[model samples]
Target: MKRKNILLGAFALLLVLGFGSCQKSDLPLDGTVSKERIAALQSNLKKALHDTTQGWVMMVQGLNANVRTAMPVLLKFDTLTGDVTTRTLFSKDKQSSKFVLSASTGVPLLSFSTFSYISQTYTAANTAITDFFFKVLDVTADSITIQPFRKGNIYQSEGGAIMKLFRASSDKMKWALDLLNAPGNTGNIFTQTSLFGRDLEVRLKASFATDSIRSRTGFYSWGGSLNVVKSNTPITRTYPTLNPIVIEFYTTFPIPANAVPLDVNTVVGDGLIYWQPTTALTPADYFLNGPNATINFLKTDYLLIKSMTANSVEVYAVDASGNVCITGRIGD
Candidate 1:
């Protein structure tokens, strides 16, 4: 009788294990729920977009590489008409594009199907950011959490980028345009910025005084241009693209072999630079190979003007986990 009881208990355990394995295989992508729950979520997201009369202030924290420190982009969505309007600091007026909420992949996706250059400033098929589809992670009455939606309508295995849209004040657009070209601004790129466990007093190289004055650095090599450059002398480099916007710094610091080097000239200068691009010729992230070894490298991989204001400039760095490691900002 004892042996029969033991045999029956073993069979029951096997059945339980088999059922649990089957349940795992049946789970859907994107961690989505059943068909009915998905429908409910879709309806809720629509309401979230439509109920906010004042619109949203949107900002993207890039996917461990791109860093956008500009003022958040303003977005107003007309859910009834499917029109999404945008207001940029650089624009005098707002622009509109079509948007859709799709759920064919067992997950909700907010897709921006149209293209606008002015809009592309923040959302280009971008190195650090994109103005394309966003996989909706969570949504509420006043905020929506999102990630850039790569193709396949699936959750990306590559860690996702997080963006948030908060309620905007009615007069937020007042901070637009004309403010971008405000006067009485000295052209200094960065003051003292420390990131990746290093300090970069990003002042114009006093030793390279003759090479000083103004430097035109391109944040991107394509249609996008970073226009904060004006040198006392004309740039003599002969490159096809206006990329690797160079910022030279010379201290008794040495370059790290594994550190990311920024050299628009293709020759890494003594001062830490952030412009040596990969084959795509685009600035690559991952400034360090192992621990913040840049203490010795003295190289900086980024020095673009804050995309938000020309009155002040900032040079900052972000870590892989989307933390602001450190920041240095300057006005004038």
Candidate 2:
């Protein structure tokens, strides 16, 4: 009778221990989601949208057209297991986009686009263009505010005239710099002379337009003397002092209107030229201009030529010269 009792007691103890283990296993391991994490996720998403490179593509396909003009849209986060379950937001175009971000890397894995138009002007000149800026504004245990930088015109041009003036001066300086072969001397007489002459023309036009306006019968007209004294300033340009080893090449590529020419030394040290033939030649075909040379086609990171005609091939690369670096043809 005692043995039976002992066996029964041991069995009951085992069963109780197993039940307790199972209950503990079923409980949440990391506990409930915290408010701080939600806030971080929101801020990170905003920053990513704002920090994209120029020419980045945004896909908009399915939202109402008027929604594209709205300011900032709020971010909604769903949290599970201390990670963001999903992020939903609308853009200025009132079209909704969804992002799935990993909590660990903060990198978005998948992005969806809704029909919307981007209202902010991204192609504006002479100003930093930021489409979006987001940061975690505030966080609570259950909610967060993803602060968005939206619809800002902080550096907007004062007027069209001002914008024109800015562009003109910028162009004049750029031309002068290019003429000098991007020399380092800031006080070159030729550059200064050219700049002065250009500036004078710009100023004269501005002044004439400003002073000549007259209102006759509620209509504006120019009433000042049409004849004006012309300045006899001599036009001259001096070449920039160049380093001995710097090589310069003239090409048809248009320089950015606002770009300041770099000194020759700065370009040569970091520059390499890629030379690709205009014609498509197979591995067995010898390069017409280059002796005993054929192209070794590489499919790796090398640039791909789309079509090869008798005279030219269409090619592109990450850099300007990537197409020029190939030396071998396809077979040999």
Which runs of model 1 end up more than 4 angstroms from their true locations?
Answer: 1-33, 64-71, 89-93, 117-131, 151-159, 170-201, 204-332
List lDDT for all candidates, in order: 0.43, 0.23
What would the TM-score be for candidate 1 when compared with the true structure?
0.46
Give the runs in model 2 whose Cα sits over 4 Å from its true position.
25-42, 51-332
Compose the digit string of candidate 2's lDDT tens values, residues 67-106.
Answer: 1111111222232222111110110111233334333222
Best by lDDT: 1
* Highest-TM-score candidate: 1
Q: How far is candidate 1 from the true structure (C-alpha RMSD, Å)?
A: 12.2
Alpha carbon lDDT of residue 34, candidate 1? 56
The all-Cα superposition gives candidate 2 an RMSD in Å to the true structure of 25.1
lDDT for model 1 comes to: 0.43
